[model samples]
Target chain A: MMKIFGKVAAIVAGSALVATAAFAEDRKSYPAPKDHPLSEIISGYEFRTPETRALQDDDFENPAYILLDLGAELWSTADGAAGKSCASCHGDAAESMKGIGASFPKWSKERNKAITVEQQINICREEQMQADTWKWTKDPNMLGMTIFVKNQSRGMPIVLDNSPEMETVRKLGEEVYYTRYGQLDMSCANCHEDYYGNYIRADMLSQGQINGFPTYRLKWNGVGSTHRRFKGCMKNIRANPFKPQGEEFTALEAYMMYRAVGLPIETPSVRN
Target chain B: MRFAALVLSGVFMASVASAEEIKKVEIVDGAVQASLTGKPGDAVAGAKVFKGRRAGNCLACHGNKDMSGEQFHGETGPIMDGVADRYSTEQLRAIVVNSKKVFGDHTLMPAFYEVDRLSRVAKKFEGKTVLSAQQVEDVVAYLLTLKE
Candidate 1:
């Protein structure tokens, strides 16, 4: 009887140690007030000229409408091995996908990781439509779809639902934002946080808030997603960017969503 | 535990290591007299470095009177007209090496050579300067030719 009791006690203690190890890997924490010093900065929208602001306000003048038009058509047209349109499964995106973009970069139980809206779209294409995925960084079709999805959530506040599972990734996103890289030796914070309203030559710098993404940038003269913009910034800093829709970008997206918590979703917005 | 030990060893190596292959420059009487090239700087190579996107990209900020035909010449900094009259060749070399030594540290122009003061530098460039010693001299040689 004494021998059996000793064995049971050892097993219980060993399992407890294993449980603690697993818990350490998923340590839950959000950015404290002291952690992110630039938490109170406003969105980049406030720094734009009146002419640019007017362009974003009117849907007809906005050039992103061209991509939106393409996306609307693609939503109903069948193009995959399944020969089924997105409308066939989801039905009238205006009705089903309204405010959906605001919640994305959400935790996906199937993949066991946080997936961005672009990644979710690709997963749906491969699994349900039996089609090829759009290259999240360069493809026009991908940008159109992303712009269209985000346009649906216009005027809605960004909310990630803040699941406990997403906490680890959200922290990692914050880490990526603050960690400095490149030959220029600049981090996202050095420009966006430390020198928010300063001028680097002719261009005025903003605080780098990403509330109005999927914006039509004058530099590109076309629609661009958040990940696409991230790539451009990496290049500008002379750092080789990671692939779009890759784990690093998804983590960055997760952090961006949390940062823009109170701001309205203004996708397909205009920017210089 | 082994991974942690390896990382610690790498950090230790990084701290004690000095720059190699990159020739060092000297500062004398508020000027940099050390030339990357042992001989006179070639004006031709210097011009290429000034305008090329891969390196100096000086024209992006400072307008050059010599390159008047070029499109989108910036008006941010003083035009490079008669720059030779403004500073001596050695002083110009000093400015390129570490501009903060002459201009205040707050200026937008980057220090082309000094390494220790920089932040968020890439891993491969831990203790290295941006322009090689020869490249800096070449840029200096090119700027010297901007006299009217």
Candidate 2:
């Protein structure tokens, strides 16, 4: 009985020590090697299930191809008062849009911010195509067009330009990535950086790469933009998500793409 | 090792005694002595909380031998096979209440009942713990059954 009480006393004492220690908030920075900065990056694509990878490899088998086909149709159809199609200004997307998506989320002087491909699409619709901008969230035309444009750049490496003018915005993106938020007190880095290879249940976490924006997720059952996926992640941690195409999400997209430099663009990539 | 340093430190008894004074649960020496029913918890109900998404979400980062058939079991943290042999009931209770109490504050596992030291918490959830005292007990009860 004396030994039993002694064990209980030790257990109680250990619990107390844990409760009172100062909580450490040690944040880790990017472990980029000076010689080969891009070598450290790992795309979530490498971690996808074989079935999902196979679906992405075959265009005919990929459900996202449906959206890609629709986008091709929308590219030729004239719209708005000008009756100008996207093909009108830039003939044959294969020739005009080869490496365009690879350098997206670029700094736009007129907009005074980093703009995603979706925003650029809207800008073209208003100025060039003269059609009303597609809806921001879950618009079939938007997703289709996005996949169509991004698909052209498939196998091309992501290479967003980091101009001096865009440094502040890029820094803001980094801040957002590292900042812990929500009731769970988790930052994007907590999962994508620190626990990159660990499983958060059955789902193996990749580095939260956005090289495959407008991805076709089995869970989503439809194509979703980078902003759409970011909103979903925020909601998962019980945080109030910002507007889908808002400044915050666009900034996050820009930062994500920057982190994914050198990763081959895999638009409409399949994921579980 | 940090774990060895902590064990050797004299602060264990001092911290546990202070925590017991503030919380609803009792602490003996260094272990938690919490009991929702003043009896052993129901294992069946405990399993539900263990796998709940909004509650414990243990499966989010823990693989369990008993739950091998369940989809999406994680492997970030140590697996739960034979966990009953590894930790005492009181030690398990303390971990369920606040994992930092056993592991440390930097662990990915959230403190299911700790209401303090968290940032950016939604206004509606302010001062509210992640799990009820009963749920903590239930989870502890469920973990105790995971024998090798």
Q: What's the true lDDT of residue B55 in model 2? A: 59
User: Second chain TM-score per prediction?
Assistant: 0.78, 0.77
Give interface RMSD, per candidate.
18.1, 5.2
Q: lDDT values of the candidates?
A: 0.72, 0.74
Q: Candidate 2 lDDT, tens digit per residue, A1-272?
A: 23643464466446434422211112112343355323367667667777888998888898888888999999898998789988898889988988878887788898787887888889999998678999876898999988888888998987767697556776787888887666666788877766665568767777798877788889988888788888888777666677887887877777777787777888878877
Native contacts kept, each candidate:
0.18, 0.58
Residue A213, candidate 1: C-alpha displacement in angstroms: 2.3
Q: Candidate 1 lDDT, tens digit per residue, B48-113? A: 667755466777657787877665554334467877866788888987887656654533456677
Interface RMSD of 1: 18.1
Q: Compared with the true structure, what per-residue lDDT tens digits does model 1 show for residues A1-272?
A: 23532453465446545643443343322232445464453566666778988898899999988888888888888878998778889998988889878878889898899988788778888888998888876677887887788778888877775788788898888888876556654567656654544444445566676777788888887778888888888767656676788888888888877776656788878999
Best by TM-score: 2
